[model samples]
Target: MSTYHIPVMLKECLEGLDIKPNGIYVDVTFGGGGHTRAILEKLDGGMLYAFDQDADAKANAEEFQQHRSFTFVESNFRFLKRQLRFHGVKQVDGILADLGVSSHQLDEGSRGFSTRFDGELDMRMDQGAAVTAKHVVNEYEQKDLIHILSAYGEVKNAKTLAAAIIRARGMKTIHRNEQLREIALTCAPRGREMKYLAQLFQAIRIEVNDEMGALHEFLEQTPEVLAPGGRLVVMSYHSLEDRPVKNFINAGNIRGKQEKDFYGNIIRPLESITRKPIIAGEEELERNNRARSAKLRVAERVQSK
Candidate 1:
């Protein structure tokens, strides 16, 4: 099959997983199956389960239907534990999650994920999802928009931009991506217009899909889903996504707060395999600019206490 997305840091992610040929594995974000196909190549009697909610991803998985060792789950990774249990899988040997928008999603303008494209304001990772960018931009209260911009995007002038959105939508409902872009352009800083626009779109996308909320739920289930000595390899494109993954591996929670037992031992389900996130090599950067922001973190499930 043709390439859909060039998997970022492919070698590093494979090394991080420390794949066992006979082990059970999962690729939670099987966008174009770049990583999934690689993992499948290394498997013998092992089974690999891939998860994605996007309709396009489901279609991409069709080729693997005949592969005895592969299974494609048509659901979000947030339901990780429940889905695994339903499939009669108590635990898996390794889990790989690449939390980034797929190349196809952005390239398809009707998906409304790119700033350069003009399409309807619909940015749901899962098309079936109720909320969309249109709902967020037009229906959210001014204060809520300000909070989403500041917290999710880290946009500096969140209040001003939120006010602008409120005013623009007040005149007419913002139905298209271009309409919202123009409103944000008016509030964007002179030299950083593109960056500001990207941040603004990122904030709305995150809210529309409940990305952070799904991430927290998924992370909480990793420990229970992983077998002892199993690896959890994750690649995140932004700090917002990386922080929780780092904290959960180190502290057993998304908050990064360590809890102590009666004997003063810090309790956590996974042990950090990498103290710092691994970045893509210079060669990979020259080949694919999207790999520039990618950060890979690895952790292992600790033996039962």
Candidate 2:
């Protein structure tokens, strides 16, 4: 279970937090504990709570071996509100969520998270969870498949791909990565194999985890969980994740627009720290390919009751 998770945009996230030595903070996506370690170093009297839905992330959780103020909770972050309340805490000074699967999950052959890997069709981030890519491919209807592929995967040929899947799935249940790849290839244009297949896989993974839906819910609770002047630093790998976060912080809604009162007074709980999303640099892109798509957005909670 020795997995490699290279935290993307580490420095930017740390700066975004504006870490207070004695302020309570949370790392919602504790993949490999890379960022968690950085967060710990910046804290003294403050405590850091890290959450990861995947049990496998615990394998790298050992980095904080001697940490007294770090707590790792294994669960989906969509329920972040309830979970933190259960801990007898209400507000936190800072919260960071890296809303993407880790490199370890993608590199591991058995995880089926990568299109490069030929394994089972299962892509459940939390192995203990019931839903997987298999269910999405095997049970999803043509209309549903089209929606997932187009919206989540951003597949250009979503309708064609969905049709191909439906046709192939009828003959037999697709249980392995190789079979799924073949289906994708057969449906895709001859030269578009790589691009088409990757998009299809991305679509299925998002659907299996309800990544977009969960991200929306998580952002909805952020304003409530954050204390006044608390920082909300979020790192998103895809537009779907970043868009909502960017909108919510700037306008206090998911639409990324400001709200105005009858008297034209602007009211919002959070203020967008970055007018545009922060992208990884050339150095980081070269070091970690994952950084190519990473976008870091930060916001500070405004004074509100």
Candidate 3:
């Protein structure tokens, strides 16, 4: 499990959940089962439902299947509410989502999740998914590409990058990571080639997986699925992912809009547990560089007054 991917801020995530010995819980992003394994340990009579869309992640979860309390849901976390209902689990004590691509995904060149590796342009988290990064790079319109690059990846030269991709693909389909990388390099800034490439790749990957859309859908369902006072512990890797998590926790909506009651009391489903997000300690950071960009926020489900 450790080799598959180290669970970033493992201790912090556990603490944030405030685990109860016999309470039901869910691990929404069961990549590598690192977090799921830890959560299972804390359960005595409690049930733990682990969800993942990746085929590799399901294989990693096989080790825990024999355990009486563990149930692996082979689906995207975006279908959280419906899946829980199917399992007769209307509400849960806690839901922990470790967002973004796993270390295993990035290290495997064939997955095309890493800019460092030259491989197929496929970046589908669900291997069976219809869309791939190759499709997005070769088929998406220039304006659409620009929007994803700018909004999802925060790429500084989105317009130039999109135009370059459009021009290159017009001559031939962009079918591999290297092909797209070369086109992106043409538009990259002088000294920030690596960063620019990463942003470009991130944008494509996000669109291929519909990451932002899935995230918004998943966040909207959390309040409905979590039992009152239940914890919503999420660790996001980038601002694009982190912003919505932060907003949902603080304002009860993804837009960060706070609806109030007639008396002016905030009408929200969750309350932020900490004033700021929790960061990994130096010890953890040195051991795991992935934790460097991670921002963890914990919020408890609350009923409106």
lDDT of each: 0.94, 0.86, 0.91
Which tens-of-lDDT digit does each residue in 1-305 have in candidate 3?
Answer: 67889999999999999999899999999999888888889999999999999999999888888999999999999999999999999999999999968888888889998888888999999999999998898888889998999998899888988999889999998888888888888888899999898888888888998898999999999999999889999999999999999989888899998899999988789999978999989999899998999999999999544
Q: What digit string (tens of lDDT, one per residue) describes model 2 on residues 40-101?
A: 99899888888887867876776675798888777788888888888877999999998878
Global CA lDDT computed for model 2: 0.86
| List of clashing residue pairs for candidate 1 | none
Candidates arranged by TM-score, highest first: 1, 3, 2
lDDT of 1 by residue, 55-104 (tens): 99999999999999999999899999998898999999999999999877
Flag regions of model 3 displaced more than 4 Å: 303-305
- In angstroms, give how far residue 140 of model 1 lies from its true place: 0.7
User: Which segments of model 1 are wrong by more than 4 Å?
Assistant: 1-3
Error of 1 at 109 (Å): 1.0
TM-score of each: 0.98, 0.95, 0.98
By TM-score, how accurate is candidate 2? 0.95
Q: Which candidate wins on lDDT?
A: 1
* Candidate 2, pairs of clashing residues: 247-256
